[model samples]
Target: MKKKLGAYLTNRKIMATALLALTLALSACGNSGEKANEGSADKETRDITIKIGYQKYGTINILKADGALDKRLSEERNIKIEWIEFPGGPQLLEALNVGSLDLGHTGEAPPIFAQAAGAPLVYLAHEPASPQSEGIIVPKGSPIKSVADLKGKTVVLNKGSNVHYLLVKQLEKAGVDYKDIEVKFLPPADARAAFEKGSVDAWVIWDPFLAAAQTATGGTILVDGTDVVSNHEFYLATRAFAEKYPDIVDILLEEADKIDVWSKDHPQELAEKLSPQLGIDVESLLLAAGRRNYGVQPIDEELIKAQQAIADTFFNLELIPKKLDINDAILK
Candidate 1:
C-alpha cells in the first residue's frame, strides 16, 4: 500500500510539472503574437514622422490652422504630421536641407542657393504667380519714387531671399547700378519698424507685409513683383526623404493645388483668417490676397528659363558663388 501511495505521489508531481510547462509555452506564444501585431500596427500607422514646413500666408495656413490637414492624412495615410514653421524662405529651406525637416516651402531662389551650398535639396513643386506679393515700397510722402529713386537712399530687405534678386533685377531693369543704392539689409519686421520711424526710405519685401506696411505707415507700393519679378514658391525636400515618402509628396502637391484654388475664389475670407496670424490689418491682407494668383504653376522649360535668367544674373554679379543648373534641381 505504501509503495502504491509513493508511486501515485510521483505521478501527481509529473502531471503538475507538465501542466506548468504547457501554460508557460502558451503564454510565450501569446506574447509573440502580440509583439507581431504591435510591429505590424507601427508600420501601418505613422511610424516615421513627416515634418512639414509652413508659412503664415495664403491658404496653406488656413487649412493647417483648422487641423484639417492632420485629419485628412490620418484618414488616408494613417500618419501623424508635424508642422515646423519659419519666418522666411531661406530659414525654412535651411531646415529642410539639413535633414531637420522632411519638406518645406520657399521661394524660387532658395532651392538654387541650397543646391549651390551642396545641400541635398531638390524642388518637388512650384507655387502660382504671386505678382504683387513681393515688391519695393516707400513711405506715403517719401521722396523715393522708383528703383532709380533708391540710387542713393537707404533701402531695407532680407538678404539671400527671393526679394534680393528682385531688388537687383529692378535696378538693372531701371538702368540703375546695384551699388548706386544704399541697401540696408534687414528682415521684414525690422524693416517695417524702420519704414514706420521714417528711418528707411524704401522697403523691398513680400506680402502680406508689403500690404501691411502700405496701410500702417500710410505707405505706398512703389513697385510690386510684376516689375521686379513674379515669385515661384517651391516645395522642396532632401533626395532621400522624397524617395522614402513619394506618396506623401504627391498628397502634399494635390492638397496645395486644392488650397490654392479655394483661396483664389475666396480672397477676403482667406485674408481675414491670415490677418491675426500675420499681425497685419485685415483690410490689407484682404487686398493682398485678392491680388495674389493662387495656384500650382508647375515649373516647365519656360519657367526654368525665367528662373535661369535670375540665376545667371546672380552668378554674373557673383551674388551666388557658382553658376547652377536649374534642371538638375527640379523634380517634375
Candidate 2:
C-alpha cells in the first residue's frame, strides 16, 4: 500500500512539472509573436519627412508662418516638414534639381529654365497673375523716364526670375530691342544696391522689393507687368517625390489654398504676419499684400499655353539651351 501511494505521488509531481514547462513555453511563444507585431507597427508608424523650399515672401512663406501645414501633416499623416529658404526662384529650382528639395514655389520663368536644363520637375498649382506686383523702377531723380528710354542704358534684374519675362515683354512693347539695353543680371539685394548707387539705370524687380524700393528710394515705376506678362506664381515638385507621395502633394496644395483664402480676406493681418518673416516693414509689406492676387488654381490649358509662350520666347532669344514644352513639366 505504501509503495503504491509513493508511486502515485511521484507521477503527480512529474505531471505538474510538465504542465509548468508547457505553460512557460507557450508564454514565450506569445511574447515572441507580440514582439514581431510591434516591430512591424514601428515600421508602419515611422514618420516621413518632406523637404520644402520657399522664398522670403509669398504664399509658401505665409503657409510656413501659419504653421497649419506642419500641424495637419503631423497629426493626420505622421509626416514631418523641413522648410528651406532660397534667395530667388532660380536658386530654389536648382535645389530641386539636386534632390535637396521635394517641393518649392517659383514664378513662371525659373521652371522654364530648369526644365530646359533637364530638371525633372512637375508643376502642381499656380496663383493667378498679379500684374502690379512687379515693375521696372528708377531712382527718384533718375533721367530714365520710360521703358523706351532704357535704350543703351544699364538695367539690372534677377536672371531667370518672373521679372525676367516682365522686362522682356515691357521692352518689346516699348519697341526696344533686347540687345539694345545693357542688361545686368543681379539678385534682388545686389540689384537694389546698384540701383541705390546709380550704377544701374533701372531695376526690374518684384514686390516686396518693388514696394521697398519705391518706399525707401521714392523710385518711379517705369513699367509694371500690367497688360504685359502673367506673373504667375507656381508650386513645383520633383517627379519622383510627386509620384511616390501624391497624397502629401495634395495636402500641401490644399493647405496653401486655405492660406490664400485667409490672406485675401485679411490684407492687414497678412502684412503684419509677413512683415517679420520678410524683414520688410509693415507698410511695404502692406503694399505688396494689397497688390497680390491670392488664389491657388490647378494648371489648365490656357495657363499652359501662356507658359509655353514664355518658353518659346526664351528659346527664340537663345536664353535657354533647348526648347521646352511646358506641358512636359506639368503634373497630370
Candidate 3:
C-alpha cells in the first residue's frame, strides 16, 4: 500500500508539470499571432499615397530627379508618392483646394491669394529669401538706367506675384508713384517677348526665366529685390493632409532640407542636373541656382507678421476679394 501511494503521487506530479508546459506553449503561440497581426495592421494603415504638386524648377524638381523622396517614402516609410506638375503656384494651390494635391511649394504671394479665395491650406515650411533671384530687367545696353526711370514707363509683370510686391516696394523707395507706372500683367513668356521687342520698358521676372532672359536676350537687371522684398518661397499643404499626417509633413520637410544642403554643397552638379531638365543652359542654371538660398524654415511669428503685412498691402490695394487674417492660415 505505501508503494502504490508513492507511485500515484509521482504520476500526479508528472501530469501537473505537463499541463503547465502545455499552457506556456499555447500562450507563446497566442502572443506570436498577436504580434504578427499587429505588424499586418501597421502595414494596412500605411497603404496610402502622398500627392505632391511641383513646378518645372526648384528643390522639388531636383528631388524628383534624384528619386530620393520616392525611395524613402515608398520603401522605408511604406507610403507611395505621386508627382503632379503645375505651371505655377496659383494653379498648384487650385489643385490643393480641389483635393487633387496633398502638398506643394510656391512663392509667398500664392498662399495669400489662396487664403483670400477661401482655400483650406497651411504654410508648412519656407525657403530663405533669395532676393536676387527675381528682378526687373531691361534690354541689354538700354538707356533706362534706374528704378526712377521706370516712372511713367510701361512695365510688364505677373499680376499679384511675389515680384509684384517687389516692384511696388522698389517703386516706393525710388520715389516713383505707383500710379505713375503703367503696369501690364503678363505671364513670363509674354513678358519676355514684350521685353525683347521693347514693347515694355522692363520685365519683372524670376529665375530660371530671369537667368534665361539675361542669357538669351542679354537682359540687364535694373533692380533686384535685395534689401527690398524677401522673395521667400513657401511650402504649403492642404489643411486636411497636414492634420491627418503631420509625420508625413515632417518627412517631406526633412527631405527638402536635405536637398537644400545638397544643392548648396553641389551647385555645379545641380546646375548640370537641372540644365537638361529645365532646358536652360548650364551657365544660366548655375547663375539661377547660385543666387537662390535653399534652406527650409518653420513658420514663426515674425514670418507670419511679414506675411500679414503682405496680406494687408494686397487688401488695401483691393487685390484680394476679402480681408484675410494670415494667422488663421498658419498651421499650429
Candidate 4:
C-alpha cells in the first residue's frame, strides 16, 4: 500500500509539472503574437513629413501664410509641413535635386534647367500666364526706351529663370541677337541693387519684385511679357514623392486652388494680408496682385509644346549641356 501510494504521488507530480510547462509555452507564444501585432499597428500609424521649397512671393507663400494646408494635412493625414524659402527658382530646384525638398514652385525656365541637370522632377500644375507680371525695366529717366535699345547694353536678370525666356524672346522679337547684349546673371536682390545703382542698363524681372522695383526705384518698363512668353508659375514635386504620395499632392493643389479663387476676388484683402509678411507696402503688393492671373491649370499637350520650345531654345543656345525632352519630367 505504501509503494502504491508513493508511485501514485510521483505520477501526480510529473503530470502537474508537464501541464505547467505547456501552459508557460502557450503563454509565451501569445505574448510574442501580441508584440508582433503591436509593431504592425505602429507602422500603420507612422507620421509623414513633407518639406516644401518656396520663394518669398507667389501662391506657395500665400498658401503657407494662409495656414489651410498645415491645418488640413495635420488633422486629416497626420502629415507635417516644413516650409523652406529660396532666393530663386534655380536654387529651389537645386534643393529638390538633392532630396532636400519634396515640392517647390518655379517659373517655366527653372524646370527646364533642372530636368537637363538630371533632377527627378514632375510637374503637378501651373498658374496661368500673367504676362504683365514680368518685364524688362530701366531706370525711370534712362534713354533705353524699347527692347531694341538693349543692343550692346548691359542687362541683368536671374539666369535660368522664367524671365530668361522672356529676355531671349523679347530680344529676338526686337531683331537683336542674344549675344549682342551683355547679360549679367544675378538673383533678384543683387540684380535689383545693380539696377538701382545704374550698374546695368536694364533689368529683366518678375513681380512682386517687378512691382516693388517700380515703386522703390521708379523703374520704367521697357517691355512686359505680354506678347512673349507665358510666364507660367509651375508647382513641381520630386518624382518619387509624387508617385509615393499622390493623395498628398492632390490635397495641396486643391488647397492652392481655393486660395487662388479667393485671391482673384479679393485683391485688396490679399495685398493687405501679405504686406507685413512680404515687408512691402500695400500699394506695391496690390499692384503685384492685380496683374497676376490666379488659377491652377492641368498640364496639357499645348502647354507641353510651349515648355518644349523653351527647352529647345536653351539647347540651341548651348545653355544646357544636353537636349531634354520636357515630357519625360512631366507627371503622368
| Models, CA RMSD each | 16.9, 17.2, 15.2, 17.3
Q: Give candidate 3's root-mean-square deviation (CA, Å).
A: 15.2
Enumerate residue pairs that collide in model 2.
none
Clashing pairs in 4: none
Using lDDT as the measure, name the better of candidate 1 and candidate 4: 4
Whole-model Cα lDDT per candidate? 0.73, 0.86, 0.81, 0.87
Off by over 4 Å in 3: 1-45
TM-scores, each model vs. reference: 0.83, 0.86, 0.85, 0.87
By lDDT, the best candidate is 4
Candidate 1 TM-score, true structure as reference: 0.83
Ranking by lDDT: 4, 2, 3, 1
Per-residue lDDT of 83-114 in model 3, one digit per residue for the tens? 99875677888889888999998888878888
Model 4, 1-332: lDDT tens digits are: 22442353355456545754655555567877555554332233238789999997789999998999999988876888999999899999999999999999999999999999999999988888899999999998999888999999999999999999999999899999999999999999999899989899999999999999999889999889997889999999999988766667767877888898899999898988888987888889899988899877777788899999999999999999998898898866
Runs in model 4 lying further than 4 Å from the true structure: 1-46
lDDT of 4: 0.87
State how far residue 88 of model 2 sits from its true place (Å): 0.6
lDDT of 2 by residue, 182-301 (tens): 999998999989999999899999989999999988999988999988799999999988766655666787788789989999989988988887889999988898888987777778
